[model samples]
Target: MTEAAGKSYDGLPGAFRFAFSRSNSWLFKLYVAVALVLAGLVTIIFVFALIVLIADTVDASDGSISLLRSFFVLVGLLVVLPILAPVLFVARRHRREIGDDTGYDRRLASTGFLFIFAVYLGLVVSTPPEQQTSVDGALGPVLEVLYGLPSIVGLVPPVVAVLVIYGTHRLSR
Candidate 1:
């Protein structure tokens, strides 16, 4: 039998060739690589924040605030994990779809990944804790719960979620 040839889209139209070529365009690869790296970094940061929050709880001056802060940190991780895990899957699979002739939702998924990350960034670390509710250096009753990262990280998920929903819908259609 004749040797099986590699994918040959030499005669295909330019756009089709680009889409189904046996490799990713530099743009797609770079986008995915950057996004994945960011996600990993963010995950590590979240874990570290979690550990700090937990360790701080043992001898916290005010147990309520410590407990609340710890609770929010844990909640934030739960939210982040779902979004981050899917990104890793889509990014790896996009290699074939962009390079070796495959079909899948790449742009939409990548956008979702970045969107969630940006949101988490805002929610978890939106403001400096020292400045959140420290007016004239007189701590307020709301000081503890008010300065947490989760409250701010909360902003990212909804926007990312909306984008993801739209992207998925477009992909489906």
Candidate 2:
């Protein structure tokens, strides 16, 4: 009977408890599952990037900027699923397993980040590399900024998602 009350006594938000709680009150295994997912997502991203690099080298496009923009598009799409699903599933399963409130409110948090990532990627893809920035970015420094920006900012979303969900999960335990 690993219902909400059965599984958790802290009376935290349903989404928090749901995501970190284990099946049949198996907190330890739930932690392990989260760890595995984190590990797998990293590997998946690494392999995908390697493939993209290989593809680019084989058919070097004159429009490297366009290809780089497409890379950001791919990165966002890749990150969204891994960042979102398991956490939401945890919240959802709680409703069925333990009669929790279904955490619709908390589950919607995923959409916010998703939309942000989509917008950021769209900007990266649409704006020409030289004009992507706002601070008079047509010069060489602008090109340097554009080249560096994606790799730097591109990494933040996944790391933030991991930190947030992992923090919540571990704190629950």
Candidate 3:
């Protein structure tokens, strides 16, 4: 039988793994399942709030799609993934330790920061025409630095999560 049928998230702390534990108690498992669904609902609500916040903060002059506005919204949306990544990564790693290889962890590790970099790189290519022409001046450098700062900052959390997860995994081994 599979581990989930009888095993639990052995290496994880009780607090960390409570929702993910594969305990034998049917009621506990059902409660966890319901909690997960509720968590998903909360995340959906968060995304909607983020969308509204971004839309309000970014001024799209004449109701046209400004590259700067798009950048803000995309970065906001991108943040949602990393927010949940570490918890999910830890749970999966602990589950694997207990002999439950669901095959999702491999995909998660392989993708890593590729998605974040890809989207950020795409945004980098969309430099506002006004900014492009000022490339030779002093303000140009400052503007470019300011423009790229958000994407650079956005990369930190996911990269840190990956490093922390790898470090912990290595130590566990």
What value of lDDT does candidate 1 attain over all alpha carbons?
0.50
lDDT of 3 by residue, 70-104 (tens): 66556555544443443356455555555444333
Give the CA lDDT, 0 to 100, for residue 72 in model 1: 76
After superposition, the stretches of candidate 3 with alpha carbons farther than 4 Å from their true spots are 1-19, 22-70, 94-162, 170-173
lDDT-wise, the better of 1 and 3 is 1
Q: Is 2 or 3 the stronger prediction by TM-score?
A: 2
lDDT of 1 at 64: 90
1 against 2, candidate with superior TM-score: 1
Q: What lDDT tens digits, residue by residue, belong to model 2 across residues 44-132?
A: 77678767766767656567856875687666556554444444545555544533433432433343344345445544544556565
The sequence of per-residue lDDT tens digits that candidate 1 reaches over residues 44-154 is: 887888777778776767869767876777766655554544333333333334333223334544555566555645554456655564544455434444455466455
* TM of each candidate vs. truth: 0.45, 0.34, 0.32
Q: Using TM-score as the measure, which candidate wins?
A: 1
Once fitted onto the true fold, the runs of candidate 1 whose alpha carbons sit more than 4 angstroms away are 1-25, 60-70, 82-105, 113-170
Instruction: Give the worst 10-residue stretch by lDDT in candidate 1.
Output: 1-10
Error of 1 at 3 (Å): 22
Where does candidate 2 clash, by residue pair? none
Report each candidate's C-alpha RMSD, comma-separated, in the order given.
11.0, 12.3, 12.2
